[model samples]
Target: MFDTPQSTRSGATAPPPASHPTLPADRPGPHSKRLGYIAVIATFGGLLFGYDTGVINGALEPMRDDLGLTATMEGFVVSVLIFGAAIGALIGGRMADSQGRRRNILMLATIFMVGTLGCVLAPTWETLGVFRFILGLAVGGASATVPVYLAEMAPVERRGSIVTRNEVMIVSGQFAAFVINAIIFNIWGEHDSVWRYMLLVALAPAIGLFVGMLRMPESPRWLSSQGRDDEALEVLRQVRSPERAEAELAEVHALALEEKESQTGGWSDLATPWIRRLIIVGIGIGVFSQLSGINVIMYYGTQLLENAGFSSNGAILANTANGLFSVLGVTVGILMMNKFNRRAMIITGYTLTTTFHLLVGIFALAMPDNSLKPYVIMGLVIGFVFSMQALIGPLTWLLLSEIFPLKIRSFAMGVSVFTLWIANSIVAFGFPPTVSALGISSTFFVFAALGVLAIIFMWRMAPETRGRTLEQFEDDFRIQHS
Candidate 1:
């Protein structure tokens, strides 16, 4: 394996790659500002993922009332997109690996437009569900692709912070969805097509992503894999400063050659012990992230609040609080991410969330069934959201982006994220029924048990990957498995 000279900054030794050229401290210039814009554009996919998944929380009830949906249909509508997302994640991963990350994301942007259009125009619940599933395909693909794209292109110093920005955008998108849902519902409270309007707002960002990505560069790492080093260098120069970009491009090219000579790029590559172990770790992180039941809160917070005793409008308004807190939590987490170790964050987050779940379950069970009980439980639920957003939420995506080798980064993350969506689908599809049959208290207790398992699994399997470069971490992971 080729190794680049290391530089120690703030107690962490950075691997070969320097800070991205554009943002180098030696000279602050226009390139730095432009790179920041590019990061925002790339993260638009994350925004759409957040908004599309979260809109269902407030829109589902109106949609149910409008289309006369039953419990099964309700679950179907909510989870159908997750099914499409699963397939999209798998196919998008392969496509991102084979095609280019930028191209695949642009294609996803178009799919987002189509899926949003379908949902907006559908006259029946069946049609809306189908459209939602289609939308999910795009969302899943974007979720898998965007983070990898960001991770691959980001400089070593900023990788965690940059990749987690996608998480921030995701929660921001969810917050936007909640706010939009509330505003639209409040204005057109009795309108027949209010739900349709809720679904349509996603188109604006979908269009923005499609247009913005047109001017963006492809992943330089992907280009290097295809033996297009010159193009890769040029693209790197666009994002990095000239000196650092040249140095980083050389390092990337060297690694590409090493990986090419080994020819370990696919299913067969995974057979190697080190590669296999990394893949297992990658998948474990993805599964544990979903097993936290965060999506259950995002997709069904309104309904969960309603079950806790809030009225319809009250539920919608209260759910907006969930979205806002989620965004806030993610912001706080991202700020702390660069400052702390990844393993510490994950362990701390899971511990707090598990404690919240147990407390919430106990509070719900013990509190009297008065109006105050609902508000108190809702407060606990909000606390749970805060805990999740602040810790596990961003850390999960950050770790997935960090753990894999470059040769199979897209494929590995795709498979891992695909598993995440599948896990998400299971929680989403089963949550309503679980609540109905087992009641909210028992349902959360089950998640609490899962959370405890996640904590143990993480402690045993997850590495401290916060400040390491992808290349350096790859060597460490290889040694660990060996």
Candidate 2:
């Protein structure tokens, strides 16, 4: 929905103001370097979020065996966290908006720690699901809040790269979890406590995030919006070049004034035509992103492969391949984000994914059920996952970060991403039944049909937001559908 004036200037090309005497004349010094480290440390919340959500891919079978779980209990164990995450996403936004980003994250870190503990020490399926749900609350909130915090703290030029770096970290965290899970599962395949080890590994990163985020500053934009200019400036100086800091502060102050005057925070903002349209676009992105069935692959790929005919070991190994491809695809997507138009990338991604879905369905139907079927189906499934990670995955998070106004960034993102988790839960819970009834080919064909619809929706409604500042993007969003 953006209508901002396009500029080809690189991030480094923006000129400093003449009057801001405190601004750096050349480049940042050692202090700025340290600030970058702090940002990474603070964003480790994302890493923990990624690991906790993805670890189940390897651990599920062991968990099922240990708990004597049926299909419904297994689904509950996996998808329960998603249900909690949906709630967290809804409430975490308000917390971030009112309590401040730093505080909310710290609280999330505590939740993360507690959730991990609950999972590790769980005596039964019932206990494990409860803890996982708590874990999901923290993960969901962190997902909604971390990107906004990163975006606000980053320099305008580096904003996309910095915020997207968290996405990279997220995928990397998932990769790390998969690798760790493989190693642990391989070494302790016969051990009764194997799943416990897999689940407990998440605690290290949670501890790291909790401790690291405590020393980080609150978001400067959030502070400025609250009329705490001095604190905001102090935060800005810590993260930005001295010369650039003042100008950025002025810009933030101007925007905060506008926000305050308009009283455009919270659900009421959605009443305005432009705001309503923006929220719709945000929710659309969330729904389409999930409807791509990425979570179906992430949360249930191993089961899907087993159904295709692989032994348990083979399925676990093949699932690892899926994780690796996901990491690789996200790497490619991040590299291309700066080079490609957002809308074009999304359209191309949906098209490719839909085509793969159809091909996989056809292959599943035509090939007689045999040992070769698992490997063949594995190849197609991994291919679809790669397409999603390379295209839709990064784009979905990127667009969510790009669209909303500064005033409602956290709240709006929470609402949209909360819906994302709900969608994920629906797929997770329904996938087994869907597969049993419709068969794999038919199930994927349904996804393929949805993919085509997503493509059409993107072409008509999604906006190109690449290479624009947050302030400029906001202006563009206000009038995009007018």
By TM-score, the best candidate is 1
Q: At residue 21, give the lDDT of candidate 2.
A: 31
Error of 2 at 386 (Å): 1.7
Q: Write the per-residue lDDT of candidate 2 for residues 390-449, one digit (tens) a residue.
A: 888888887888788888888899999999888888887778899999999999999999
User: Candidate 2 regions off by >4 Å?
Assistant: 1-32, 369-373
Alpha-carbon runs more than 4 Å astray in model 1? 1-27
User: What's the lDDT of the predicted structure labeled candidate 2?
Assistant: 0.82
Cα-based lDDT for every prediction:
0.84, 0.82
Give the TM-score (vs. native) of candidate 1. Answer: 0.93
Q: What alpha-carbon RMSD in Å does predicted model 1 have with respect to the real structure?
A: 4.2
The ten-residue window of minimal lDDT in model 2 covers 11-20
Model 2 lDDT at residue 466: 70
Candidate 1 local lDDT, 1-482, one digit each (tens) = 11122322223454333343333332456656666777899999999999998888778878888889998888788889988998898889889998899999999999999999999888888898888888988998998999889888777777777888999999999999889988999899698779999989999999999999999999899999899999999888887778778877777777788888776467887779988887887888888888888888788887788888899778878888888999999989888877666777788889988988898789878888998987888888888889899898898888888888888888888888888888888887788789999998998899899999998888777776755667767876786567
Total backbone clashes of candidate 2, pairs 3 or more residues apart or in separate chains: 3
TM-score of every candidate: 0.93, 0.91
